[model samples]
Target: MTGRKALSRALDLSLWKGALTTAGSREAADAVTERAVPNEPTVRLTAVRRLYEVSTRMGAGRSLAETLQAVVDGVVTGLGFGIAVLNLRHPDGKFEVIAVAGSPEAREALLGTVSAADIFDGEFKIADEWGRLRFVPHERLPEGEVVGWVPDVPVSADPSAWHPLDALFAPLHSPDGELVGMLSVDLPEDQRRPGPIHRELLEIFATQAGLAIDKARLTDQLLAEKVRLEASETTFRLVFEGAGNGMATLAFDGPEAGRVLRVNDAFCRITGYPHDRLIGSRLLDYLTDGDAGRTRRELQELATGTGPYRFERTFRRADGQDIWLGGTAVIVAQGKDQPRILLIQIDDVTARKDAERELQHHAAHDPLTGLANRRLLQHRFEAALQRSRQRGRRGVLLFSDLNHFKQVNDRYGHEAGDNALREIADRLLTAVRHGDTVARLGGDEFVILAEEIDGTDLDALIRRVEESIGRPLAGIDVPVTASIGTAVVSPYSADLDELLRTADQAMYEAKHRDR
Candidate 1:
């Protein structure tokens, strides 16, 4: 018979008066049988149709507990049973009531009452006393427990007992051979016992249910991953497009020229060019006039894989202003045609370069007098000595200490002393030749490097410095004297330290004579 026809026959058999007669005592059997079979087929068909529709509706059910509950509801209502319960194997190998349906009393009594161990062992003592017979797998049951029912053993034994008659338990197994849970059913004692037909039906239902549950779980996981991936993409886009730093990509075309493929807003702002104008333009179009050829050659070498170059260059901005850019460019070709091309990265370094130049000026020149400081004087003297050695020439190193300068500072304060030093520096600068270097050696002391000078010329340079110092200050009319000492050295003298010491000693001797 077709499934619908078979269902009609089962309904007819369940409602048969003959079956009711064999159910048990007339009064009790009639009452239970009346409740099991409705007065009309329409009500029964409606229940069956609703159960089938809902069970088929299990599209993406993730939770095992929820799916099990759905199964319990569908089986009990659809099959015209009084009660249904679902039991699942716990992690510890015990069984727990996962879901239950039917009367409140039946649900409470069956909930958490039985376990897999109890059912597997055919421990039906509670069911037997309650007029209920437990069904186990034929292969699984103990031989003694597989007994045929005798007439003497009343079907409706007692109401207070643990088990119910017409109970069916079928293991719910997944497609991968995992036993997920068990489906159990109960009916009044007078109802027909569960047989192979009922077992087969329950097994099919459980298989469909299990597959639906797995699908739902996978769907939920995929949705969560998709959300995370989209979120990551949003974060990346915000950082790449909204960053303050200039970021761009250049497509390599040839040695000196490449097209700008992408540029962020910061790049446009820094280069003073619009995005539309910058894209597809050659990188060399912005290069300063003097660096065009050299940069082109470097880019060519980079493209040919012959050199790695990193240097600073000046670029003309959109407004025709020159801006210093410090950056590196390299060749990048991800297996494309004409692989010889350059990828350029540039950053505005005008502020940084200016700060470096200012620092260098402060290090070598005195802040107050604008003369070369002691450090610069030492460097120049060493360079001059090296040159003198190469040409067999001699240079004079003059160390001069201002005599009685402390009295001026003590009497007039440091401000006036500073003015006096400024006037002295100007006089020394005027007295020295263009090639000579005059430096302040700190605390009212000065040093002069006279290159390619003999003894006579050295004496003249010293006298000119002394006369300038002794000249009266123009505004303050303060007379100052500087005691001068000179040390001559050739590059043959290997000891620079000894030369500086001799110069210092001679300065002290001249100070003593002036005093």
Candidate 2:
């Protein structure tokens, strides 16, 4: 009896193992079939296949609107809903109808009239008072209405018969927790309560639909960013290549003399050299002999990170032309390597410097007479006085005023007066020694500073100035004369302001005497 019992137990164990194997195989097959046919009998297997194909095609679409319309069509066809509406919220906190399908009248009624408050707060009401069965919001229903729309229903029951006409609302949410839109399905009372399986399927579809919407939005955002970046890069390249100023980058390896690393097209155009010829060439090779040692030291100091250097230096261009460059050098490091002494920026300021020198000339000289203006004369006068005082010598200040300048201007116009001034300046310049300073102190007034002179020599200088001014002006046939007053100051009594005042008084006395 014991042997038979043991054998029976072993056979039962073998039967159990076989049963487990068969059950596992059946489960795997069922999984494959479910994947193959996602929809149930309500939706034919072929319909499910077509739905997937359409979804795949729509997924490859570029426009978000097209993709969404395809999704809405697939869901409506697959689920057999009477009315389907896809509403999307905009950035302005308003809901917009994105996709709709069903009766034409119903679609037109729901298009732009729906709002967030209408769907979430307001209740759907079904009434028999109207000739045709229609669903309206509860607020629109008259007072004392007995029958209202279905409020809540079980997930497992057949809602089609119990609540023949009802409304369904499902919120579409994105993965990042943004409320994208609301999906609403309206059906008759007979199709009110959806079954457990149907509800589960709807939930799955909703999740997948949200993911598709997010993917479409992300694709659009990426495309826009790509366009913006490309535009920015193009703008930078154009400016770098077409700018009128010269720019160059030098690499600092060991400070033996930094070499040119990169140069823009403007640099090549300005220097008359091609980019290939300048790269890897030492910057010191272009410097003139007078500035070579200083330039070398400056580049070395930049390599040591002392300070930024900026100065004017003459460089030999490729065509053997000497040009002035206003250069600036600094130290920079792109990576963890040692700091690169970047002799980075240089501007071909030859034209600007030349213009600046011309401007300086205009500032120091009078336009009408081409003589030194008062500002320049004052600067020279102070320097001469200081020199005379240091050397214990005497100097004379002669203040001269034209005798009849206004009468000449009134008779012959300002142009002839200007010619007279020019002629007088030329004659006075010739009469004075090269060391003397002559200046125009505005309308019809002039001054001269004669330094390192004795009393007799001073008198002779004054006589020469008077003779030169009395001579006939070239363009004007009239003879112009100037009344001159001389003031002499030795180191003992040389006060600039007092001497000027005394010279003015003496000038008035000379004019009175000439009159």
Candidate 3:
């Protein structure tokens, strides 16, 4: 069977020879045995030197396409082929050209023709044995048919540098004998039929190419993963450093608990600290109620996966001014064997909180004289009523009207009356105890709330109001006296309007008596 196999192989070689030319072969068995001897040592050494050079050059490829292209370049440079093409096998069991390298004119012409035919990504039928090799001589290939196939590869473009009249195809196979792809070669006219020695060299190159291709593809994948990871990290870094609010990471355990681990640019600016100075400093030093103990509890919550914590706090900047900061904190677990840490975000709320207090003051007080308006006076009235009922203390609500206030306005002009009213408002403020509430019910009407008073103290308080209002105005020449009346808030009579009405009726009687 081995002899028959040898005979069959010899017959195949002979057939190839005859097909490329009108050559005849010797007896089949004799021809097979004669061609089996090794070539000269010098030729083998020369091939070795060139192939080594090709191997080193092919190492430059970092991707699949570049590597496959390097393989084609190696075949032309190492094996001295005029042109070389690396083709890949597709899932449909057909081959398509992927890479090309050769003489300048041949490469350009062939590539142009291949592109026009869509041969790079397109499939072409080829047998499994083609992985062995096949040679097609210029004469055997009918110009009408084969030349027509590459109709666009113009011969007149650069006839001197482009002459590849004969070609060889050597298909590559994996170790498992599975066909991977093929390498096509165009030999010089003088050495159109390469010896067995040359063929053997081509096979060695094909094997190296397969291994190189695998490596290149793996490298390509690793580089792609690296690029994706770098992009993700860049995006996170931009958000952390560029955000308007402050952000920081803190140590959650050990002696370093509450220590600032890292702070972004925003945090640094907020705290008036440089990046180097802030790191390793305890965060509690800059925060109110942010001690190590509190931080540990926060860490515990994070370890237990509770949830994010939110609160308003005061942070001391480097300049020693306290700033109100609204903040959110959360524990971030770093997995087993790694200590968990805390993430926090803070925003300045000092301005907002101050604005809120100002709004409350404006809503409850008179804008002109900065005194308690009716709204605040009524609020005080309810509190006084509740206190008198609970504590059994006597309380009085006094109503006072400026006597002849409209007359002062008509005689001295409204501005002088305003001056007189301001003097009266000031006198009313000083006449009573600090605990008492004095309010203006618009225009010339004023009310005073005095609690925890006996009958004697209430009478003395009324005398003081009468004396204060009787004083001359600072800048106005009007004599503004007040018609004052008082109502006792009994434990059984807690109604606000009833007290106000009783006070009003008594004041009307005082005015009539003065008239």
Candidate 4:
């Protein structure tokens, strides 16, 4: 061997000795030191010191990038490799050349370079396994299967001589055996294939470096997660405060479940409540008096994960006015160990609810007389019949037709006729029992449904209603009187048409008698 080769071999032996001393037993180190370079204690100490220094820097509280860079630098300077490259695996399953320790030209050429994961898999699969180190001989490379950078060195006829195309790699793995990165080295100072001692030295250094890299990576991940959580919190705060509708976050477990944890400004405005009164208050506490219990049950169901609940509820305001709100509630699970929460979004719908009620009333009432129309009367009659049947009670229907009502409309026109009809409606309503249903079947025709009555009571009610109807109009001298008929409902009364027909026939007979 040439002097340069001899010196390189001596240095390689020294590194092996030092690695054994630091990583394992001093007795093993002594055994190796005595077999090779027995008098080169100074060289072995230098290698041991260099390895310690590199390991310290790698384990320092530095960034992942910085640690990885230190790993590659240590491989080159401490392990006597002319070039070292650390290729880190990314989430996308590709390997990126992150840190390079070599000539400036090689660093510029290889740093930031990316390789498909398939390439690494192929190389590792075919390469000779030198313990943990992978050695890919130049002859083993497949055609057109480009790997990474190759130094400009000519191949030698000697079988062990280093070639430009030969590749050596040490894969760094996490504690859980996941491959995190790979370290590539080339151009050993001896200009020959690495010996077993050289490979062992690389493995020892890689094991320690992998742990340091993994630690740095974990720290980086934790910091990134923290930043993301903070940003998410800020975004949520902005949206909750800026929303036009009421929004609330409520606790979802334990005794405090369904109580307000956070509420937006719109919630305070809608409830006429201040921030202090709303926070930590149970959602059911604001429900209108009659609905509080039912709402509480519904909220309890939501807390048990039976939601999302979409509903309309009446809530009592701070000043005791009830207002309608349309809302949705959904459970938001924070984390596996954290308590879940409920997110409620609500819109004030009092105006809409009032308008709906008004529409319903108009649909079932006579527009002209403000009395129950035929639709409402039919519904009430059915209910009343059901009650009478269930309780075995007697019910009565009184049908009345105004005498000479058409003449009054002809003389005074429709406006005065409407006023007269309204007056008549008022009088009839006043004359009947509070529970009786007064309905206008059509023009000049009215019916009263008086439930739970007897023959004597019916006679008294009919006479009272006739007297009210016989009174003269306020603004007109035209006289109007009612020709009345009655139908008594037994417990078995089931046909509404039959009852109405019987009353109609009696009404006609009474009219004839009056004429």
Q: Which candidate is the best by TM-score?
A: 4
Residue-by-residue lDDT tens digits, candidate 1, 1-515: 01101111112123234554676575766576567554333332343344344454333234555566667776766555545666666556666776776545445544564454444444343232211124522233334532322112234333332122233555554434455566665552235454322333344345445444443433432111101101121011111233233545565564434677667676788889999998888767788667887876776666655222356878789999988876544443322133333434456888888898889999999998888997787788789988998999998888888877887788788899999999899999999988999888688988888899987787788889989999887555456788777778787766556776788899889777767
Tens-digit lDDT string for candidate 4 (1-515): 11111112212223233445464665654454346442233333344455555555555434888778888888778777777778888878788878877566556666686777765676677789876678888788667744434343334566886766777888887644567888888777555688644665576567656656766788752112111101121112111453445777788777877788888777899898998999899888777666877777776775654324567889889999989987666554443345666767677888989999999999999998999998998898999988988999989888898998898889999899999999999999999998999999889899999999987888889899989988888888888999989897777886777888899899999999988
Alpha-carbon shift of residue 423 in model 3 (angstroms)? 4.2
lDDT of 3 by residue, 1-515 (tens): 01100101111122233323432333442344335433455455556556656655565555777767778888767786655766666556655557766544344434422222223221122212232455544444433433312211212222222223445666565422356666776543223257554665675566556545544544552112111101121111111454345777787766777778777777878778899988899877776665435655655665655434555667788888887776656554433344546767666778988898899999998776667898898888888888878988878889999877787889888887777777788888899988999888889888888988888888889999989998877765667788998898767665778888999999999999999
What would the TM-scores of all predictions be?
0.45, 0.46, 0.48, 0.54
As for model 2, its CA RMSD to the true structure in angstroms is: 25.8
lDDT values for all models: 0.58, 0.58, 0.61, 0.71
Q: Estimate, for each residue in 1-515, the C-alpha lDDT of model 2 and write its tens digit.
A: 01101101111122123433454665553344345333434333333343334344444445677656755665556554444667776666667777765445434544554354344433333422111112333234446633322223222233233232244555565544466766665442123344433343344345445545765766641112111101121111111232234556576666533777667676888778899998888877888877889977766665554333456888899989988887444443322333343534456778877898889989999988888887788788788878877998888888889987787898899988888888888989999998888888889888888888887887788889899888777656565788888787677655656777788889999889877
The pairs that clash in candidate 1 are: none
* lDDT accuracy of residue 345 in candidate 3: 68
For model 4, the superposed segments whose C-alpha errors exceed 4 Å read 1-239
* lDDT winner, 1 or 4: 4
Error of 2 at 360 (Å): 4.5
- C-alpha RMSD values across all candidates: 27.1, 25.8, 26.3, 22.2
Please estimate how well model 3 matches the true structure, expressed as its whole-model Cα lDDT: 0.61
Best of the two (2, 3) by lDDT: 3
